[model samples]
Target: MWHSPSRRRREAGAANMTRAGRTQDQRWVATAEGEHLRGRRKRDTKPEVTLRKAVHRLGLRFRLQRKVAPRCTADFVLPRHRVAVFVDGCFWHGCPDHSPEEFRGPNAALWEEKIETNRERDRRNTTQAAEAGWIVVRIWECEIRRNVEEAAQRVAETTGSNEAPRRRRPAMPK
Candidate 1:
């Protein structure tokens, strides 16, 4: 069964640790509880809400979590413009600028494998979308949090054009 950090800390008497006599057991318990809380908080973040509001205010029409061609479900899809936007979470997507060393702690091998797989999957998806002639825009959660307007403007630049040129496939060989 999963326990909340507050409950776990209380059960472990985390608040009563003396500065000089802090036992290894108490330290481990506190660290574990802190990591668990951080993971949960990251999962419940509201970056998508802010992005949606900003894009809407810019008068952009887009579909959320919509499926595009070849097994791609983009975070935001502008079908008319053939643009797909992805709002990547820093922790999950392993943001180069913000991913903490803690993510690579404990089960280092397992985390490396998992995060690498996620990165590869993102690359494959982006490549496939581009091959299908869709403009792909990737926005990191941290970037949106830092500046919603800037993130929205980046998205708008990709999809805001009134006339998107049609993509022509190569001519068939004889």
Candidate 2:
């Protein structure tokens, strides 16, 4: 039978799809929304930027994406005081405020399992870091975005020497 090039291409593409659908361990289904969600970054998110800027303004400097343990890396690490900060995203980290089913879409069960796994991993990492004498500060995304200064202050207090954080002043131009 005669066929157009576009039609033939579509036919060939459709043949590659699995009739059985996704496997058990599949991360996301083949969809545009799934691809977009999968592309999210683990570090340097908007909340992280806001918190970092606030902390810097408070005269505090820390390492970004620093490795606290062999398996886990923290969002911010203060080597001097052994403090590790993690800014958890509501959707990805399974925050109680948001419903995972909404974000999960078609993969509701899979997404719930994934979120639970994430929370468990976070808990394990926190415990391990604490046991290693490292202070783990887990700040929620909403809290950081709502008041960056307050978040910075919390970090400073946790990592500081019990004194007020000194704000840095820019040098006057000659």
State which candidate has the highest TM-score. 2
lDDT of 1 by residue, 1-174 (tens): 998766666678877644444654444323565467445542225887788788877777778777666877788788878999888888767899987656544555556566678789889999998988899999899999899999998888897575443456899999
**TM values, all candidates:** 0.65, 0.77
How many pairs of residues collide in each model? 0, 0
Clashing pairs in 1: none
- Check candidate 2 and list the clashing pairs: none
Error of 1 at 38 (Å): 12
Q: Which ten-residue region of model 2 has the weakest summed lDDT?
A: 16-25
CA lDDT, candidate 1, residue 46 = 85
